[model samples]
Target: MTQQPTPDAPTVLLVDDEAALADSLALWLERRYRVRVAYSGREALQTFDESVDLVFLDHNLPGLSGESVLEELSRRVDPSSFAVVMLSAAPGDELADLPVDAVLTKPVTKRDVFDAADRFVGDAPEAKLD
Candidate 1:
């Protein structure tokens, strides 16, 4: 039997205080998925809409912490509407209880980014409904 393709491309929100890094990662991910970038957690929550499919958040940010952003996102969107992944240079237990899909350490590769994105967006056939 032939498999049905996904209805829409996954939309990723990449939040980092480093503008260059965020830009580069957004550029790289844009080739394969719809990508959005924010320099801080506050900016991320402000820029966020209901269309996001995945979120790659840096733990340390200027205005708000990544954990705060995750909390805001969790409140605003349904659990299945998007997957939140924390990306940090310093990985710790603080993120363990956060409502997130995954926690990825920094110095992340292109392959790793893509793999994580795929894991969040690829498996769910009904991800777009919400």
Candidate 2:
């Protein structure tokens, strides 16, 4: 089994309606970060807190869209403190006004995930992609 990083590892929340994808991504991220999974946008908003260092948010969700969740999160926390990476199956041009740190297209590779982590969290190594 892979070892969890140190206690001070950054916490990341994965919000996606696709259970399989979310689960797989969570497993990958857990290697170096504290990962939380929320299947719906409503759950994402409800479960998020100040402790979250980064968020991988899916654009399409059941109750609320990723944009709505980001809007609500922005009101609660300072944008600079945490990063939000919006995930979408299509172009995310409409979400340009949102205070997200980055936008990643769907079917993201492990390298893509790590690249975002490195961009927002820093100190990320170019490890092998799953």
Candidate 3:
């Protein structure tokens, strides 16, 4: 039997400068995870903690880039402790050798994000797009 998450489910951070994408992803994952939104890489770093279970990070931002943010995160936490997925409109070649768990191309649908979330949060509830 699949276990349903309680009020204190694992946290998932959605870091994207695009408001619509971030908001949509948050809504999609909120049922099974506590979703936090960060509009910029700096904001993401400010809100990040050892407790975060996953991160959907956008490659481009006004200030610090997602690659830089990932680098900083690697320094502060163990690579295996949390799952970090880079979302980039550009080719993934630029992010080669980064400590992220995966790299997703931009314009990703809610289903795509949900699928990734499922890998990290086993037995998580299905994400209903409304």
Clashes per prediction?
0, 0, 0
Badly placed stretches (over 4 Å) of model 1 are 1-7, 123-130
Task: For each candidate, give its TM-score against the true structure.
Answer: 0.84, 0.89, 0.85
Ranking by lDDT: 2, 3, 1
Taking the tens digit of each residue's C-alpha lDDT, what string does model 2 give over 18-80?
Answer: 999999999988878888999998899888999999999998887798888888898888877
Candidate 2 is scored at a TM of: 0.89
True lDDT of residue 27, candidate 2: 90
Model 3 per-residue lDDT at 91:
57
C-alpha RMSD in Å of predicted model 3 compared with the true structure = 4.2
Ranking, TM-score, top scorer first? 2, 3, 1
RMSD of each predicted structure = 6.1, 3.5, 4.2
Off by over 4 Å in 3: 1-5, 125-130
Model 1: per-residue Cα lDDT over 32-78, one tens digit each: 57678999988899888998889999988867988888888888878
Quickly count the clashes in candidate 3: 0
Residue 99 lDDT in model 1? 75
- How far residue 8's Cα lies from its native spot in candidate 2, in Å, is 0.4
Largest lDDT belongs to which candidate? 2
Clashing pairs in 1: none
Cα lDDT of candidate 2 equals 0.85
